[model samples]
Target: MDLAVAHILSRVDVQGADVLLIDGPSGAGKSTLADAIVENWPAAEKPTLIRMDDIYPGWGGLAAAGEHVRTRVLEPRSLNQNARWQRHDWTLDAPAEWHDVPSALPLLVEGCGVLTRASAALATVTVWLDADDAVRKERALARDDGAFDAHWDDWDQQFARFVRDEDPVSSAKLVLRAS
Candidate 1:
C-alpha cells in the first residue's frame, strides 16, 4: 500500500461530510484502492460503496452508464435521499437486479467514469489511478477471467475518448500511478 493512500484513508472522516470518488482507466487499481479504504474505515462510520461496473449498462455502454449514475445515484444521494438503480446482469444481458442505495454519508464510488467534470463537483475528494497499458490489459483480463477480452479494444477506444472529453485526472484531487 502506498503511504499516500494510507494517509488519505486515515483522513477520511465518514461521519462528517465527505464523498470519495475513485476513477481511472480499466485495471488501474481503482477498485483495489476503494476496497482498501472501505476496509480500513471505522466500522461505526458505516461507509457505503457504489461500483460503476454494477451500474454500467454493458461493455459498450460506458458513456450511458456515467450519465445513468449521475442522474440516478449521485443526484438523489446529494439531497440525502435513498436512491435505487437496476444492476445490469452481464450474463443475462439485461438488468435483473435492483439496488437500493441507502443514504449514507461519505459515499465511495469507484470506476472508470465515476469522476466526470459534473460528478467531480459533487465529490469531496477524487483520486485518479493509472498504470501502463500492457499492465492494465493483463490485470483487467485476468480480473474478469477473460470475460472482457473481446471488448478490450473497444473499451480502450471508448476510454480514450472519455479521457479526451473529461480529462478526469486533471479534475481529480490526487493522481496516483498504480503499478
Candidate 2:
C-alpha cells in the first residue's frame, strides 16, 4: 500500500490535474493512507481533500451520502464548477453548513463509498483498501473510543452492501491489503 501510494504520488503533476479516490470499508486504513499521501505530497502542490465522513448524514446515511457526493461534489467538479454541498452535523442531526468546493485539481476523496463506479470514472486513480474483519473492528472501536460501538455493525452492513453493489475494488487501479 505504501509503495502504491508512493508511485501514484510520483506521477502526480502537483499543479492540479489529478483526482484520486481512496475507498474501503471502515477501519480499512483509508484515512491513514490519505493522510500519508497528503503528508508526502509536495507542499507547493497540496490538493484539496474531502472525507465522506463529513458528508454522511448520519450513522445510517451511507447510501444517501454517496449519492450526495456524486451529485454535489464530483459532478460539478468535472464541469469545472464549484461544488455546493451540505455538511451534516451528527450531533445536531441536521445540515450544519454549506461548503462551496473550490475549483481545485488533484482532489483527494477518501472514505467508504467514495469510489462508486460513477465517481471512479472521473478520478485519475482509485485505490481500494481492505483488512481483516477482526482487525477492522478493533481499530474502529479504538479510534472512536467506544462512541461508535452501537453503530459499528450498522456501518459494517452498509459497507458490505456497498461493496457487493459497487465492486469498487474491481474497478480500482490499485487494490491494497491495508493490514
Give the best candidate by TM-score.
2
Stretches off by above 4 angstroms in model 2 are: none
What is the per-residue lDDT of model 2 for residues 28-58, given as tens digits with 9 covering 90 to 100? 8988999888888875767778888888998
Tens digits of per-residue lDDT for model 1 on 12-126?
Answer: 6767647788889999888888888888776577567888898778888888888877777778888887777778888888987778777765788889888899888877888
Every candidate's lDDT = 0.82, 0.85
Candidate 2 CA-lDDT value: 0.85
Q: Model 1 Cα RMSD, Å?
A: 1.5
Q: Over 4 Å off in model 1, which ranges?
A: none
> Ten consecutive residues with minimal summed lDDT in candidate 2?
8-17
Instruction: Please state every model's RMSD to the true fold in angstroms.
Output: 1.5, 1.4
Count of clashes, each model: 0, 0
lDDT of 1 at 98: 79
The TM-score between candidate 1 and the true structure equals 0.92
Alpha-carbon deviation at 141 in model 1, angstroms: 1.1
